[model samples]
Target: MGKTIAEKILSNHSGRDTKAGDIVIADLDFMIGQDGTSGVAIDSFRKMEAKKVADPSKIAIIIDHSSPSPNEGVSAIHKKIREFCLEQGVKLYDVGCGVCHQITPEQGLVVPGNLVIGADSHTCTYGAINVFSTGIGSTDLAAGMISGKLWFKVPETMKVNFNGQLPNGVYSKDLVLAFIGQIGADGATYLALEIGGQAINEMSVDARFTISNMAIECGAKAGLMEADNKVMEWVITHSKKKPNPQVADKDAAYKQVVEIDVTKLEPQIAKPHTVDNVCGVTEVAGTPVQQGFIGTCTNGRLEDFQVAAKILRGKKVKDSCRLIIAPASKDILMAMIKDGTYQSLLESGALAVTPGCGPCVGTHNGVPSDGENVISTANRNFLGRMGNRNAFIYLGSPATVAASMIEGQITDPRKYL
Candidate 1:
């Protein structure tokens, strides 16, 4: 009986031979707390009466959601987080730094074969680099901060194999959306999603990051990929840390195995109020849209910007539609600016937003109007996801978003591609 990557990593951290369903207290390699949720964590830390964090270097506090302080209350919370970080000497990433998930990997805080946790659901994004990362509650985050360890009920691995070339307009977002549609919202509940195959192996690190970032949307504990040369090289070039990519055993057990050939896959979209309520773009083509958003932790990388730029280079957004572009990080924003992508988007009538979570969390930046339809690259489309329950959110790839924004309706990106 061989072990899956999840089991292997947990075993290494727990100092024992572990497997699915096993209870183990594993040492955390890194931990994160973000502004949206860390306030409660800070309060809990005080309630626990801990003198100091177990290891300040191992922990990071990010202010992304509601960044720049959308209101006075949030400003006070930011003030508290800043004061606490200064007092405790813990690393703090203030507003404009970037989304926690994006900046953590960009800064090399996430690496393969490490067990990491964050107070945010999208913490699973780190698993793209072959790390065993997942989300924790505020109290659990506090506990990890204090003791530097957390217990886990090891999850069974669900293997998803993607073979064949992705169609020109079909990107990683479409693949993940199609997978979620097949599996349903709670399909992979508490299961580790190990994605691989020809398509995945050929995907860029940015693509892998997008796929892994949305694992939480489908109830996955973590979405992992085997680190290949691209991942190894990226991690090395980005951080001072050495890479130790993890691999599943040859005969590792999987709770379920799904094989998908993306050769003929089409652009996919997730309809309002649920991520799994997905369908091909054509299914809902010509559906009018009032706004379009092209950024988030899920799809706010430089690659995403490049794709949008390619589609909107010589076009402008529909007069009836408002478009917003938010790079995931300041670094990505700078990259877009240096490469002329930012100028192209601006000239195309897209409004520029700071590099942070911004409108993705519905806190500020670009919320939709009542009864409006918004096509976005951000993950999740539940009611009120973009600051108003009355507004509808439709999730799609950057190409789809860009094309639809130009047409003022949901349109297939294949035409633009």
Candidate 2:
């Protein structure tokens, strides 16, 4: 049987010629840690009595979720990880360098066809450009750090065959949210998703990133898109060279297949508390919003900001709302400044936040107060995922967020698009 791109990558990294159903310990190329559980992971390794890391340089320690420190426990955890990374010669990216996953790709770490594991579930986001990436528990990640090998269950692959043009205001987030909602949260558990077809070709790298980033949330092992010239070009523009790109073979089999036609879609929203609890924005028209955010590892890239900036330029946010923009990386931040997108957003009254995962993980600046409602482009609307449970969160694309900020209500972006 022909192997999918994900299967091929896994086989190559297994240090053996792997076959389906063959269990192997795969060598890891890169690993990442965040503020949440990385501290415990490092501590657990420390308790192992002089266990040395396989390669410290390949480890990336990031302080994002606890950016400004949500509380005493999280703040201390961030401090411990920072000190441990510094002491162990592990590369660290503190707040202001932007979300770890977003900056990791931009910083030239998440190349294609590599097995990159992280402590956070969203680590699967790196699969967008053909890398076979996923998240593991702290203990597993710590073990991988020392041994440079990780284990997988060899998930069955599912092919998503999307066809037709996406309607205006129906961006990548919309397609993915709809797909996962229809499939249910646990539908793809322990499975690899092979995304392809005309719709995948139309979506940009950032948009693809958005889709792959949320795959893990649906319990999928990883959501992968075949790498083509578009991905190759983005790789060239962002880095010196590209790694091997992989795609599923013509006769490769999938566990299941789904076809999505985005031609007549509208802006959709994942209501508070659950990503799968989705509905068209029109269904929530009277829903009021007090804040709008347009940045995250998922949607904080330069392209995402440009879309929001275009809509908000020469316009003003309503009095009831506070708009915030935090680019995904320092490189993206610099580009937006160079292109004057920053100024346009500022002129339109959006608050310029640091180049970090601000508010995305409910850590640093932009926390919403009780009874406040937030419309954000960040992934996940889980309770307390954005700071406080008392505050409500609505997840949408950048267009809907910016449009809502202008209208101060849950208005569909298609009206403006």
Candidate 3:
């Protein structure tokens, strides 16, 4: 069988012939939505005259975008979601829980060998655990809500084999950036990238997420790494057990292969307004920073905190810069507090925000002022991504972002390491 992880997951769910570019609407195991735009999906649902969600038990609604303190509009949306969930008998979470994907595994919403779909583009982030999850539009969400089935065109697979151990200060973010820089933004359009190799096997799951979360930026349908010991450790440590998700069959099919030699990589930076606009951190060095942030679904894991906490252990941020850090999940937050990581950051004058999609979605918490320039650990820096349309945004690793806060300019993370 020509089977990628996604293919294997989909076949188990719907059991249909799936060739590249074939659209098949199959029953899904899970569906999710969040505070920022989930209301839009719910609104569209009312228009369909579908009284109840297709399978409310399988539906999960999370409120996090404007979470810590939702504005009047977002609050109203939250109330509606509560009503919808109550009426339809679905599961719901308040702001306290954290980002959807983080809590999903924590709550055991994702299981081994399941085909999951979410309403947000970063839905692919769940692929870190071998779940076949992808992003879809709100309209598609509402349709899936009515019928447990969703459609997808089987994507061609690209094998990205990363070999060699990474040198100090070279992050998974750098590796992903270097790959996309070589492939261009649309190089993997309508394609699935199967990332594996010695270097990848050596990486932590948090590092894998940093790579996979930005897969959509490359225009890839989805990006994934073969599940391995690191993946098993993640599920065991977080979910309290191993999931044993199915892997691609030994003879499963792949379309193409790409390779990365991590030993040669250095810190990478994505220039403002487009993820595809890329260069080395040295290219933008000394670009003064007014804001520095180190949280997002892409880089807000506990491992990320270990990087930033070390950089800011005994130092203060530049007088002109505002640095904000948020854990991706409340569980992570609690763990950090217990481990004194929060104190390390607080002592250094780094502000803490609630766990959610903060700043990255331009909704609330930690927004930058107009015309301000900031270096962040976020996945994208498109126009107006952080609040003000004209504000300058630079994307980098957590270490580099923390270093920039200390120096008040874009400093290479290698300096701190």
Give per-model CA RMSD.
0.7, 1.7, 1.9
Winning model by TM-score: 1
lDDT of 2 by residue, 1-417 (tens): 788776788888886756556677888889998888798798778876545789997789877765756578887787888788877898988867778889777777877787889998988887888888898889888888888888876667888877898876688888888887788788788888988788889888988999899998688989888888888887777665358888777887688998887887778899988888888888997689999999887788887888888888788999999999888777888999999998999999899878778887776678899989999998888889877989999999998898899999877877776
- The TM-scores of all predictions, comma-separated, are 0.99, 0.95, 0.95
Which residue pairs does candidate 2 place in steric collision? none
Which is better, 1 or 2, measured by TM-score?
Answer: 1
Question: Per-residue lDDT of 1-417 in model 1, one digit per residue for the tens?
Answer: 999999999999999999899999999999999998899999999999998999999999999998889899999899989988998899999999889999999998878888999999999998889989999899999999999999999999999999898878899999999999999999999999999999898889999998999999889999999988999889998888766778999999999999998998999999998999999999999999999999889999999989999999899999999999889999999999999999999999999888889798888998898999999999889999889999999999999999998899999988887
Worst 10 residues of 3 by lDDT: 235-244
Give all candidates' CA lDDT scores: 0.93, 0.84, 0.81
Q: Which residue pairs collide in model 1, if any?
A: none
Model 2, runs deviating above 4 Å: 17-21, 68-75, 240-242
**Candidate 1 TM-score, true structure as reference:** 0.99
Ranking by lDDT: 1, 2, 3
What value does the lDDT take at residue 75 in candidate 2?
70
- Model 2, residue 315: distance off in Å is 1.2
Q: Poorest 10 consecutive residues of model 2 by lDDT? A: 15-24
* Candidate 1 C-alpha error for residue 87, in Å: 1.1
Q: If both were scored by lDDT, which would come out higher, candidate 1 or candidate 3?
A: 1
